[model samples]
Target chain A: MSYLELSNVKKSFGTTIAVDDFNLSIAQGEFVSFLGPSGCGKTTTLRMVAGFELPTSGQISLQDKNLTYLPPNKRNVGMVFQSYALFPNMTVADNIGYGLKVTGKPKKETNARIKEMLGLIHMEEQHNKFPSQLSGGQQQRVALARALAIRPQVLLLDEPLSALDAKIRLELRLEIRRIQQQLGITTIYVTHDQEEALSLSDRIVVMSKGKMEQVGTPAQIYTSPETEFVANFVGQINLLPVKVVSPTQGKVKVGEQILQAGKFGHLNGNPIRLAVRPEELNHGFIEGANNLSGKVEAISYLGSIVRIRLDVEGNPISMDVFNERKLTIPSVGDDYQVTFPVEACWII
Target chain B: MKTKRINFWAFFWVVLAFLYFFLPMYGTLDFSLRMKKGVLSLLAYQKVLADPQFLASFRYSAIMGVITVIFSILLFVPTVYWIHLKMRQLRPLVEIITILPFIIPVIVYVFGLIRTFSGPPFQLTLTPFKTDILMVAGYIVLAMPYMFRAIDVGMQTIDVRTLTEAAQSLGANWAQILFNVIFPNLRTAILSGALISFALVIGELILGDFLARPALGPYMVEVGRDMAYQPAALAIMSYALTWICLGLITLFSRSNNNQRQILGR
Candidate 1:
């Protein structure tokens, strides 16, 4: 059964529609992420769940109670903003205790909760310090602690790690996941960072413009995207325009070369794109693997993985090669042969 | 060489400004001390301080200052917050209205206030208590510009919409958001406005004189009409009060080294 549900929710600002016919049902204790680029209606969806923005149409219910037009304060949904939004005037403990205090929680209980939250964020020593006294990462941690201190029914985090340094972002991201798992709180995280969304969420909802492109688990979203937008947005994938030669046989024409897409099954478009992850293509051909020849356009040594850009029959494709001590570095002008199993490519 | 020329010009202006500001104050201090003739003494200050009427008027003005500060803050802080958060399009209109007090001269403004509220359908100046009410209203209007701008500038310093949303999502009502979040964050700004309003109320004269209230401004003017040394002494005291207010603004507005470290610089 679903715990928090947004049913046909739509939001419009004046004439522009921000979120249209959005529907999602998140199960209890699930961590779901809304992943999209800027202005993709992901934050709008999260805000609706938190009761920060009232949906123009449709209902949002938590555990079967309709909260469609409820005021934010009446809804016990906790939200962490992108900017931390820590109360500068309050100490870390006081900030975390603010929600509890508002709900008339007893002093002893509120203090206990504050201590628990501070411990959760590993900032017990900085309890009395104000937000301005802490670093960006520490401030965001306090903000998260503040949100969770209320023991809200559901927690909403809106790009909370976007403002931190890259290293701090990674560390805090892991810390957030650990805390979420420990508490088993239902969480909805919004971020434009696809890697963050993929690693941190149980299910990722890829959004574009004002609609959901695809909703699936990390592996499913990366390997078998339902739409071209999802394939392009979630991860780096080379999309080659091809013509379907035989629908039942999963045969497609990639330039003058014919390739097999694993489950083409009833595809409609004449010149649909064949999608393949860069890492799926091997440097050399194996038996029963489809092979393509291209000239190396560019080789970028990116520490752990070397991304080699290649030109195949007027189309550009990239392949990621894992860096090993015995691996050969292909020059820019060298001809490269890449192969991928039939199952590795999909028609989007 | 370029810096030397710039420094010379800066020094020249500073000297000029110092003389222009302090010369009259120095003369008043000198005159206020020579009350006993030839021998410098604090006789003027002593007489001014001993007068019962002076004490009563000073107390009244101080009380009025406190009331005006409180009401101005209660009125303008929310007005500015609403303007910043929801009705931002009304800001230019609100800004014009707040500055109307400055545009209209104090005598003209007091006359308008008295004419509107004295004998009409709402005769607010009928009793002494009612007249004091009129005086406070006048003071609030007179101090509106400073109060609104202080809170507005403070509102600009922080992200008001995001903070309100954060508080609201955390189960805070509108009142809680204002008292616990907005007001505390705007402490320096509100303090600056309140002090300026208090200072303005303390030295206000036209409204008190016209409304027939026993405020310090009218009392000082009355003393100036009849007494020489005492008025000079009062002037010096008022000058010192204004300086103290300005000094407090400077001190509090230094970003509260311990409390206010803004994120992202």
Candidate 2:
């Protein structure tokens, strides 16, 4: 059995459902990310798991113990907020020692634990400073230290790096993953940043409008999205509307070309979407492969790579290629042919 | 040149507004300080401070102001935080109720409070604690509008919902979250509103005068009938008290801003 299991969990405020029939199982020591845009119920799910929010219906079990009805204080879960939520009135040491104090731990042990936590976060020197005296990154580290000092069964992070600048966010993302791994704590990280989710999570759960769209490994989620929403949301994808030409063989007709997408059961003479990543499309047309003829609409120079936008049969398709030393920049309105292997096309 | 012209006009308006507000206060201070004969004696201050009734009234008002601030915070903070956490949809209704005191004139409410408390159904007015209770109740109603607004703004600024959730996830219960998390963060707002409420209770005349309460405002009115310079002195004292409260608020806000700046760095 999974260490943490949420089955058919639902939550609603008035008439609006904030989290809908959400079901997930997190194995012990697994780091999962709830990845989606703002208001997509990622934070809500994390709150439910942390016992900050009660599920409107269904059950949440941690380590085979029912946790849905338990209050946050009794749940033994720790969460770091997006804003850091460091207690401004308390010094770093006091903040880190809060959970231990609340649980009635001995002063000597709590002090030792607080000292160890401060050292763990590399903030031992600043333990006497209040949260209002710390920088944003430092405050975030303190929050992390405080949450971890509790020795929780599960750790929850609600976009913990969202408040930092890009450089610090990147640095903390790796730090958080390293700590999660080192401690072997089951963690659920909620974030809207796709790259952060991809880089940090053992598995990514993509949500939309309070519903889980898809859940898979990073590579699986990026390469083979179950729906057009996941494909479009997880990364930049060129979604071209196509007509299914056959059912037995994955054949689809796009504009004036018939493309074979290999054997796939879902495509059968029905209206479908053909999704392809930009990196999969090459600059020159290849024989015996899915090919499209189009005019080069625009070319963006991005240092090491060139992004080419093509207007193929009235549909815009983008392709990215490494910048060659001796290559003519494709001008707007210039005719060009683009090709992609059959396996790159995903029918959604 | 255009920017300079805008700056000039802005500065002129600011100075004009300050003069318009402070000129009368300056006149009151000058009048209170001047001697009627030829010498500059401290006669006005002496007369105002020497009266037994004046001293009693001042103590009464200060005590009431402290009680009002305490009661207002006790009643409003938890209610507002609860509304923010649970019944957010009822915020507008709660806000309306908080400002009801401001909408109804004090004279009207005082009349209602006295009539209701003096009758057989509730003969609270006959008791010794009646005056204290009535005064505190009136002040609570009077202070709610400002106190609630200040707290609401503070709550909004910190995104109270998010903060409460964050605190909860850290294993804090309601009491711990309120005293340790929310209240500490709301210190500046609570202080500012408490100061305003304190000043308001100290200077309020209509309710105290109508209720026949032996408070500073009623004491000032009683002295106004017998002596002119004493009343002027009392007014100056009240103004000074308000100014001190405002100064404390300014100091508190400045320190909070500095702390935020240091944290931002």
Candidate 3:
């Protein structure tokens, strides 16, 4: 049985729909991420689960109990916000102890819990410092501690690292993963940053325009996106328009060349799109691999990898190559041939 | 050379402004010490401070000020918090309402209060106790503009919705969120507003005079009418009280700012 479930939840504000028919079943101790662009209802969906928002229809249940209409305080859920919403006047220990204090926990137990949380966040020495005295990273850690001190049924984080510097964000992301793993807490994180969602989540639910586009493991979401929207949103991809040659055989025609996709629907002789990750396409042809020739349009040298943009028969495509010491960099306007296995490209 | 010239002009203007503000206060202080003719003494202050009527009126006004501040905080803080969190669109209308106390003259406001409550379905002015009740309501109304503005500004500085959600998700109901989370965060703002409200109550004359209450404002006017040196002492004392309130505001706000600077928000 699922530990936490959101069944066909839909939320609409006035005439505009913010979330529609969102369904998910998360197991205990699993970390799930809602990944999408801004205004995609990812945060709204998370808010609904946290009881900050009410669904227009459907139910949210935890451990087989209906929690849809419960107020946030009664729901026993804990949430960390993007702004690290720590109580400014409280010391770190006091802030972490706030939930326990409000829940009327005995003073002895609350102090022990706060001490454990401070240790969990690795801030034992700084417990007396106020939120204002802490750095952004420290404050967020304190917020995480505060949320977890309640030993909540579920934990929700709404873009918690979006406000930090890049280095702190990376460090805090690792810290969050470590803490969540240690506690074995059921967690849901919402963010527009694909890297954060992809790296930190056990399973990701990619959403667009208030609808879930796909839900799968991180590798499945990245490698086998079921829709064009998911393919375009998750990572760097080259989408080439093609015409179907055979529906059952998964054969398609790109320009004059025939190519085989991983799958194709029952749309014979219909136009389709082949989506391939930029990193999957290799430079130069190899045996038993599909090849495509294109004119190099631009090349950008990122620190670890170089990305090359190409124009293949009026279609713009991108390919990523690892930067090695002896590797030769291609120039603009050069004719280049890239190869990929048949399984790399999937029809969306 | 150009910067030096600008600094000189700035210094000149500052000196002129200081003279404009302090010259009258200096004259009052100087005159207040002249009650013992040909020698400087604190006889005027001693006389004013010794009067039983002065002490009673001062005590009444102080109590009234404290009561007004408490009521204002109880009423305005939650109203402003609701306006910030849920009814944000009601903010403009609430702002206009808060300022009604400022736009309508206090005399007219007190007159309206007397007419409505002094002899109506609820005669709040039937006794001294009831009259004090009515007077407190008037003071809260008079102090609403500053109290609301200070708190609204404080609310703007923090994200109310996110903070409320965070607190609620941690098992805090509405009361806990307000008292524990929101109130502590707004301490500086509330203190500044409370001090301003207190100062306004201490010096308020129109309400006390019209209501026939023994407030410090009316007592000061009576002393000014009959005595020569005691009025200067009272004026100086009132000025000092206001300055102390302002000074406390500066002290509290500075500490709040120093803490905020550590967060860089």
lDDT tens readout by residue for model 2, A218-324: 99999989887899999889988888777667778878788887426566555677888999988787888889888998889989989999998788999998898
Model 1 lDDT tens row, A1-38:
99999899899999999999899999999999999999
DockQ of each: 0.67, 0.38, 0.57
Question: Clash pairs of candidate 1?
Answer: none
The interface root mean square deviation of candidate 2 comes to 3.1
- Model 3 agreement with the true structure over A100-207: per-residue lDDT tens digits: 999999999999999999899999999998888788899999999999999998999999998899999999999999999999999999999999999999999999
iRMS per model, in Å, is: 1.6, 3.1, 2.4
Residue B264, candidate 2: how far off, in angstroms?
Answer: 9.9
DockQ of prediction 2: 0.38
Off by over 4 Å in 1: A265-269
Checking candidate 3 for backbone clashes, the offending pairs are: none
lDDT for B226 in candidate 2 is 82
Cα deviation at A268, candidate 3, in Å, is 4.4
Candidate 3 per-residue lDDT over residues B1-265, each given as its tens digit: 9999999999999999999999999999999999998999999999999999999999999999999999999999999999999999999999999999879998889999999998868799899999999999999999999999999998888878888998999999999999998998898999999999999999999999999999999999999999999999999999999999999999999888634423322
